[model samples]
Structures are given as C-alpha cells and as structure tokens.
Target: MPEYQIFKNIQKHISLSDSERQLFISLVVEKDIAKKEIVLEQGSISRKLYFVEFGSLRAFNVNEEGRESTIMFAVQDWWITDMNSFINQKPALLSIETLEVSRLIEFDFSTLEELYKRLPKFERFFRIIFQNAYIREQLRVLDKISFTTEQQYTRFVEKYPQIVQKVTQKQIASYLGVTPEFLSAVKKK
Candidate 1:
C-alpha cells in the first residue's frame, strides 16, 4: 500500500532482517474500521494488538455510574491493545474504539508467539516498547496524583497537540479526569 513507508518508520526502530520483515508482513492482518466502532469491547477476550497505519483510537473503561474514563489514545504509528488481556487470554477490562476512520495492522496471539520463536529479536523489540509504555504509564499515574487539573491539561497539550486538536473536548476532559463543565471553565481562563 501507499502507506508502507509509514509502517517502515516503526520498523526502523528495531532492525529486522529482510526475511524476517517479509515473514512479519505476511502475518499481519490489515483492517479498515469506521469511526466509533468498538474493536475490543470490555468483557470480551482481547487476542490482538493493533498498530495504527492511519487515524486514531481510544482505550477506555466505564465506571459504575456509566461514565467513560479514557486511559489512552493511539494515533498513526502507535499501537493499541488491552495488554493484560492480549497476553493472558483473559476478558478485557478496557474497550478500544476508533475515534476516526482508521487503518490498522493487527497481530494475534499465535502470530506474535510465532514471530518471537522465528525471530528472537522480535521479543526484544516488543520488550523495549512495553518498557517504554510502562514508564509512560507510571509518569501519568504520578501526574494524576500530583498535578493540578490545569497543570495536567497543560502537560497534555504540550505533549499531544495532535490529540488536543482532533479529539472532542468531552473526551479530553474525561481523559484529564475532569468534568466537561470544568474543562470549559479552564478554557475560558
């Protein structure tokens, strides 16, 4: 596809031999999904990890009150999945939904295991990615505990301008752990 270059951009981070790359490409399944579609619903087994080729998606959970709380957003070049569920073959605690019409390359459990077995480097590649993800999650948790609402918004805006520009204010508020009304108030200031 015309977007091969963008996918290659991610491959550049971890060197893969020509044969391994060919095999990896063969194992991926490409999908095009509509905006607002739920690719992984809470309570369903999550067996795949998706790499975004275009557009965006959100991972979120519903509270007892039925309010949605966003955990993360994945855009082009990013990966999205319920990690625990995908790794353990358990029902997901989070739901993954597209925020825009999106193209994705997905790897299921069997293919991922085979990739690791066939190419040991593949294991290192994902290990690094997961380590970075874990560190980022740690920082976000610290921010949620220590930063003021306005400060959280500032950090978010500074770090993810693309998301701020494209996502709805309501969803942003939810992700920032604030109410829509409060977000509006913050914006006015």
Candidate 2:
C-alpha cells in the first residue's frame, strides 16, 4: 500500500508505531471518485469519513427553495464528512460531492470505532481535528457578521488561495453568502 499522506496527516497530531500505522491503514479503503459525484446525499445516513488524497469536494445543503448553501470544501490532505451524521449514525443534513476526479481514503464508522478501541491515540487525533474544524467555523461565522462582503472575499482568498484556484467563482460566492454577480462586481472593483 502507498502509505504516506494519511500517516503524515496523523503524525501531526499523534505518533503511531509501524504496527499501529499498518493496522489503521488496513482498516481504510481507498476510492477514486468521479467529478460531480455525490458521495453522500442529504437525508441519507453517512457511514464513512473521507480523507482527500488528491482533488477537492464540497458539502452543501439545499433549502425548501432548492437553493444550495455551501457548508464547506475539502481538498488534498483534508477530511470531509457530515459530522453530525457520522457521529450519530443518523441521516445527513449536508450532501457531499466531488468537485474534481478525486482520490480519497475512507474510514467506515464501525472501523473507526474498532480502531479507537485498539489504538487509543487516534481518539486524540480525531478530537483535535474536530476541535480545529469547530474553531474555523466559529471564526467564519464571526467574519460573516463583522466584515463587509469585499472584506470577506479578500479574507477567503487570503486564507484558501489553493481552494480559490480549484473551485468556481459561483462556488466561492455560495461559500461567502453572495451572488455570483456580486462576487464578479467585487472582483471588478
């Protein structure tokens, strides 16, 4: 097995011995996802968490009017899942779809539970991951309420320059809570 990216990501949070690494790797399944594929649909149960090895994905929710609100995006070396659904084994509130042909490492819910029991360090690693995600989301909320649209766009670009390159302007506009036309005008100014 080509074993570097996922191990590298885990090493940042917790140290794992060769045996532990092997065990964890054994439990994961690698997937090649097609562009625009819906990996998890809203209202369906989410059974797996994905780590992007290469390419990008977006998670979004649709309202009664069928308008999408982008919740988040995941790219190389990042993790993506409908956390509420994954944790509770309930129906997902967000749908996850690929933005490009992507390679991902997936961990099934039961496998993760077993891994946690066998390798306790993973619990800490996942906790840290979720904590950082929470912090980022909280800051994003504050930025939305406190900053102007232009300022928000600037900050988004500054923070996720890589994402800006990979995704469309319309997707970015959705993330920033603006219309694509507004985003274009902001870019023009």
Candidate 3:
C-alpha cells in the first residue's frame, strides 16, 4: 500500500494542503520490525511516534512481580507511542513491542516539532487522535473497574472485532484483565 493512503485517511479527519501533506510525508521514516521486537523499552525515552502500516504491536508495563499488563494495542493504520515520554521528553513507563512482523511509518520528536511549525493544522489532527485515544483509555479503565471478565471480553470483541482474529487469546485476555482460561470460558458462554 502507498504511504499516501495513510495520510489520506488522516486527511479525512483533518484537512491538509498539498505542501503540508508532502512535508508530513517527508518527515516520516519507514521501518520494518520483526515479530517480538521491542520498539520502546521501559525507562527509556520514546523518541519516535509510529504509525502502523502493516501488522500489530502492543504496549505494556511490567509489574513488580515481572508480570506484563497490556496497556494498548495498535494494528494497521493505528498510531502507537508512549505519549508521556514523547511529549515531556521523560523516561517511558511503558514498553512497546511488535506482536508480528510489521511495517511502520515513524517520525522522531525533533522532526515532529519541525512539522508542527511548518504546518499548524497537523496539530489539530494529532489533537483529535489523542482525544479519541484518551476517551478509549478512560472507557477501558471504567470497564476494568466495573465489569465482569465476560462483560469486558464482550465489549472488547464488539469494539475491536479484528483484534479478536489477529491477536492471541492470551494477549486479548491481558488487555481485558482476564486470564486466558477465563477468556475461553467467556467465549464458550
């Protein structure tokens, strides 16, 4: 697929001029990530913002006991990054890893800042994306706090049907705050 398709999808949500589009495209660097590769590690600065061109990635945090808790997952056309590290230039609390062989379009922090200056409209596009992500995170938190495992699994399936097919049951269980066995039970019901 053309890189322009990604820009065009984003354009549907936020208008951009021809020059701005070209500039944005120029700032992005394409990369191929191997399955299970770590994109960002905890306690390291997240210098890049990634737009998935193909395949899936997951972000998670390790607990004191070394258990991983899934925070977010990004598939094709989704963006993934540790916002705190990217925006504040601080150490990241989360880690991002590819779940499968993936292609990504990435922009470093400096490049993004330059793009922001060259095209202010890009900020609006990012703001909308961030707002939607925030809302989804808030809902996920609420669901984990208030809903049963089955309910969480159901909601997850309804919200991201593609994820059910693409991601492992264990990963999906982690995202839903359930055990893989419990997820199987929920599915059976």
Q: What tens-digit string does per-residue lDDT give for candidate 1 at 1-189?
A: 234543574576677666766777888888999999999999999989998888999999998889999999999888899999999999899999999999989999999899899887878888877888999999999999998888899899999998887799999999998899998899888
Better of 1 and 2 by lDDT: 2
The digit string of per-residue lDDT tens for model 3 on 109-170 reads: 88878877988777887888889999988888899899988888888889998667778898
Residue 94 displacement in candidate 2 (angstroms): 0.8
TM-score-superior candidate, 1 or 2: 2
The model with the greater TM-score, 2 or 3, is 2
Q: Model 3: runs farther than 4 Å from truth?
A: 1-3
The candidates, ranked best first by lDDT, are 2, 1, 3
Which residue pairs of candidate 3 clash? none
Lowest summed-lDDT stretch of 10 residues in model 1?
1-10
Residue-level lDDT of model 2, residues 1-120, one tens digit each, is 466687889989899888887888888899999999999999999999999999999999988898888999999999999999998989999999999999999989898888899998
Alpha-carbon runs more than 4 Å astray in model 1: 1-6
Ranking of candidates on TM-score, top first: 2, 1, 3
Angstrom error of the Cα, residue 38, model 2: value is 0.6
TM-scores of all candidate predictions against the true structure: 0.94, 0.97, 0.92
- Global fold similarity of model 3 (TM-score): 0.92
Residue 141 lDDT in candidate 2? 99
Task: List the global CA lDDT of all models.
Answer: 0.88, 0.92, 0.86
